[model samples]
Target: MTEKKNAAAIRGPSDHTIRDQIVAAAMEYFSHYGFEKTTVSDLARSIGFSKAYIYKFFGSKQEIGEVICASCLADITERLNAALEKSPSATEKIRQLFQTLAVAGCELFFRERRLYDIAAASSREHWPAAVQYEAALRERVLAILLEGRTAGEFERKTPLDETAMAVYLVLRPLADPLQLQISLDTAGEDANQLAALVLRSLTP
Candidate 1:
């Protein structure tokens, strides 16, 4: 246990506050720098603590990582809401959804994505808040699609839940920054045409 201190555990001055302080610092570090480069001691140094202080709060680096992952989940939920504020029309809201997703896939949000993917790959059955966060995101988007339907902006015959999920699946891969930059640039030539592909399919 003591060896962990020297190995790279973060230890802070206070027994109670250090843990949360370390976790908060760790969250920002991992979010900005990514998982590969972030170290336990790095987080400790940020909060005026030593490596052992961190281990006292979280048993292992993996444990610390779990907390960061939860933060990422929360971030995704917030990003979607933030994106909605940028637009007024239901049609425009859909575009904002993709734009926000693209931003979320960038360097800023990539750290959380890395953890989300890791948990998904390792524990398919349970991923704690990470999975719930995704489900909640899906629901947010579905609600928007349903709103469009109510306004006669979307296809009326197609079931709102099924169509929203289908569109999410098709657009998920395009959420990548590389794909976004390319598709959005191309989409400019057509004006929401990227969404049109999914929309038409849902309607037809």
Candidate 2:
């Protein structure tokens, strides 16, 4: 069978319901067990489904982890956007972005350490979800830079793309799952200090 056809067959006719059920069960299982230690078979048994049945929805344990990881990242993005919306200026928005992301990362690390493990694995493995999340974050930073420049609040001599990339890199330690775990103790202070430095650089 073609790859598309194989995927469809594996998903079967009740694709959405079955897929959601599998993902929900996997989230609960991974929360207690962590991602690396649990296998698809273990999740299948926990949910009262056969291994073959679980396979109908997900190809492997990592696939389930990806779904949960994507969900976690999406939640962080939502909170970041909400915080940004409340800011009156581009400078405040940029600061809000860093603070919100740092706070979110710390919350995940301390409260949901197992889910944080899944995120770390996703980053370490270069999963598509992690890659997309990074891309989305970069775009947000670029957009903020453009807004600041257009408003004459930021210097326009430097290339916006380069500035965006630099800003993203500075924020990566607080945003990237693997790095965030290592930086938790100092992430909040680092985020505030970095935001101040970035804002200074941008001043026209």
Candidate 3:
């Protein structure tokens, strides 16, 4: 984690690295100050670059903000996928998902609260990526839930899509206007509560 943090908070990028350090500095600043309040000059100065350099990389503050959100979400989806894969049971899988979200919040918020805030505010702009990520996550969850149902681990009459949507609804606030950042412990419990509620509704 320390290495990853160091990698992100750095001077410049390697020829092979996909990320740009100038953008990293800008994102860090924006996360702290917010998109509306942050300026190109501030981001440029922070990274020791001219404002022209910043504009060369990102046309506007909004573009920089959106790109940062995309980068964060891409990283987050990887963590979420790992969490779902490692859990021992469907109930635990749900817990893992929330815990992953909490960890993501820490990484994003500790690094840049404003990035998460800005992303939350302009979700529609990134809706296509968001939808793709959600579909992939939901499919994994649905498969596990179906297995649990078959094993009598969970009870449910709700369609898989509906159940998955319910789970998304519970956690969606983590990303948006509600912008609720939670501890890992709280996120885990919230996941458990949501899973339990869904299961109880399905109980015969």
User: Largest TM-score belongs to which candidate?
Assistant: 2
Model 1 C-alpha lDDT per residue in residues 1-204, reported as the tens digit of each score: 011122123433446465667667776676567665767777778778878856666766666665555555456557867778767867778877765665564534334554544333323334444445556657767888877777777777766778778877666554433344444435332334556676566442
Candidate with better TM-score, 1 vs 2 = 2
Best by lDDT: 2
Candidate rank order under lDDT: 2, 3, 1
TM-score of 3: 0.67
- Report the lDDT of model 1 for residue 161: 75
Q: After superposition, how far is residue 10 of candidate 3 from its true place, in Å?
A: 22
Runs of candidate 3 with Cα error greater than 4 angstroms are: 1-19, 48-53, 122-131, 150-152, 174-188
The C-alpha TM-scores of every prediction are: 0.62, 0.92, 0.67
Q: Report the C-alpha lDDT of model 2 over 1-204, residue by residue, as the tens digit.
A: 011122323444477887888888888888899889999889889989999988767777777777788888888988998999899989999899889999999998898889999999989998878888888899999999999999888999999999999999988988998888888898899899989999998899
lDDT of the candidates, in the order given? 0.58, 0.85, 0.62
Could you give candidate 3's per-residue lDDT for residues 1-204 as a string of tens digits?
111232223323343233366666766787668877778888777778788755654556766565565566768877877877888877677667666776676566656657767656546565444545556566666776787787777666777778767766765654332345634336545655665665566555
